[model samples]
Target chain A: MTRIGRRGAGLMAAAGLVAVVGVTVVRPQFSAAEAERPAQVSVDEVEELERAEQILIQRCIERAGFQYMIVPRFVDPVPFTFSYVVDDAGWADKHGYGAALRRRAEAKVDPNERYFRSLPPTRQEALATALNGPEPVGLTATLPGGQVVQHSDKGCQSEAQRELYGDLPTWYASTKVIQNLKGHRFGMVLGDPRYQAALPAWSECMRDRGYRFTSPDAARSEKLTQVVELRQAGAEARCAISTGLGALVRELDTSYDAQLREEHQSLLATRVDLQRRALPKARAL
Target chain B: MRFMKKAVAAGAILVAAMGGAVVSPTSASAAVTAPPPDGHLYAWLDINAGEYYHCRWVGNDDNWTNCTDWDGVARNMHDRASSVQNRGYTKEVNLYNDAGQRGAWRCLSRGEFWPDLRNVRFNRGSSETGYNYPMENRISSHLWVSSC
Candidate 1:
């Protein structure tokens, strides 16, 4: 299925290209199932929000008599990175370890970075302050780790987020907590007894396949030529699926993620609601 | 600033005595002797990598104050870093505003380098009423993990 799905509509509408005279608009095509899919914040929606944020930031910088270049966000070709194990044989066969994809991503030059570097030291400092604020003074979110973080409420970046999200401090707090939960969740998943119990079968499956790796993570870490790496990755994925390691990992991941979500339900709900409310504003921008 | 420069200079001489090459930070094409690149998370006392005074760790460090540089000299890097670089092989590095990887934190993806931490902020605060603080000279701990 195409990744854009129903969410493509938001991005298309936000493009505001329908009024451009004599322009051929290539619409994003998706299957019926995709169109009927449940509504969630898709990548396209996030991109739309980011686009709007850039616009707001540009305006803010311009208001401060500084030139601001709106750099397009870098989109990775292989979006889904297999952190725990390579469980998809098809993906492994096509893009083993995603080395080529990484190279392409690295090769892409960011004009905003170049422009910032080209400026004089004094101008660079001024531009940096204009974009990120002179100091992080306002808006703090206490994360789950019991640490306090602060950001500048007066900066263009903060101002843009405030305009889009409505409640800057809450949004900042919620998003930060949500983002930081991954590591904790992963730790929980990996430490689960069930996950440990399933590893032996997975290891045996790999051993039968002529790979001596004790775990999927070990197999993934071993560097080899493109040909060998692809073969090994494919074998690992096959073993993972055959031994039910893949399914178990997914289940544990979901379980741990749900627990984390439950722990921070209020924050997550607030963040989601804010983002949902910002959709129209983002599109309007 | 002058005192810091002098301190760094003195530290460099000590490092030189201990069989490490110290490169001037301002010298064009200055290549300081660094730790072996084995998926290390590096932080600098000054922006753009303070060649003379920097710390590299391959694993989680709960306290930056007790951490030593590649030259094996204690620099009390706690709350004194202005830049950071993540050369992690397959994981992202998390920088924390407080010790023991507590408090507000931010993730630095593999191969990502923040030459100036002034532009970065810890993701959250210790309390709902607390404010997000600037990352510059405020990082006290770090952890390397599978992902951010």
Candidate 2:
């Protein structure tokens, strides 16, 4: 596990400047400069980072005298809906619940899996070891729940992450903590009185539009014909906007996310710092 | 070849089906089941996929409290899995530490098998802070995702 060196600290200071600039231009509410303010990392940047890691993995495995396939990460055709309700009428009209897109995605076979299966037994075993490093024993992380998880620090995969992210242990811990925060944030948003108070209006709006659903999730989960599903989804999205459900959910979700970020500021800072530093390296790859 | 730690002990049971050679517990456990091909994710009651006590699922399951094992007998898999295997065709399998997919979790890539989950751990859960726990015998739910 690599410690955050002086170079890393310098990079973090630069990242802090960027965030401060963002706050100054975007949200004037906080006149004080918050060095730990979270920067919104774009999806494209994340994809680039993933592609870079795959490249590094491919190189590492090949150096170990094994053939490694660089599988491109799957990109969802439909955008993710983070809010409890779907607010984009256009998106709903085009892809109701994105069932068809999901099916299409499922049908798309992964080349990596196919290649691995085609290898002879001995070669397959060797390749697996090369890629994964035999066991999960080198790097350890204690999660927010206090569960200690470990990953192989010797694998080509681990090397690739270390190459880009700097410290594998810190990267693993911070990323896991950030990802798991979603569940709690979702639960908080669901239980919020403001969210609950707005739900009835959204439900009533949908009801008036010939749909009987108490929540957007209920509406989305109901099975219907393609044509009906499209129409219902359109109505749901419209109702979400009309009743202010979508906006409210988004606001609450963001608020909670910010609060969580504050609570785990140091971890978030480290993760964002690493990512920012890796961006140039990812682009170069 | 790096043989799975438990393959030696389970080799006798799998030899007939796997041609007297067991490379990994994934192939060993898979040899026990007939037909339906090998695309389902499996969870075992004992480490190294202990003798005939396992359940398989091809899709997402929110709860495994009363699921049937390989022998067609009813078994509770929730929070009772000591090992796991992902024989999935493409997707990665996510094993959650809590039911209803609400807790700490980890992803097992395609063809990856954990013969002994005692070495694994659920990264963390938002609400349950500061509690160190092993992943062994504590998986409550699962889902197949595109990536880890």
TM-score per candidate: 0.59, 0.65
User: DockQ winner among the candidates?
Assistant: 2
Candidate 1's interface RMSD, please?
14.7
lDDT of 1: 0.66
lDDT of 2 by residue, A1-285 (tens): 123355568668666866887745644433334544446567887888889999998999899786667777787676534336778899889877677777688677677666767877556656665666554445545445543433456667779989999888778668766866765577678778998788789989988999888777666544578898789889988998888888898889889988988898888878878887888777767
Interface RMSD of each: 14.7, 9.6
Clashes of each: 19, 3
CA-lDDT, candidates in order: 0.66, 0.68
Error of 1 at A129 (Å): 2.1
List, for all models, the DockQ compared with the true complex: 0.04, 0.09
For model 1 the TM-score comes to 0.59
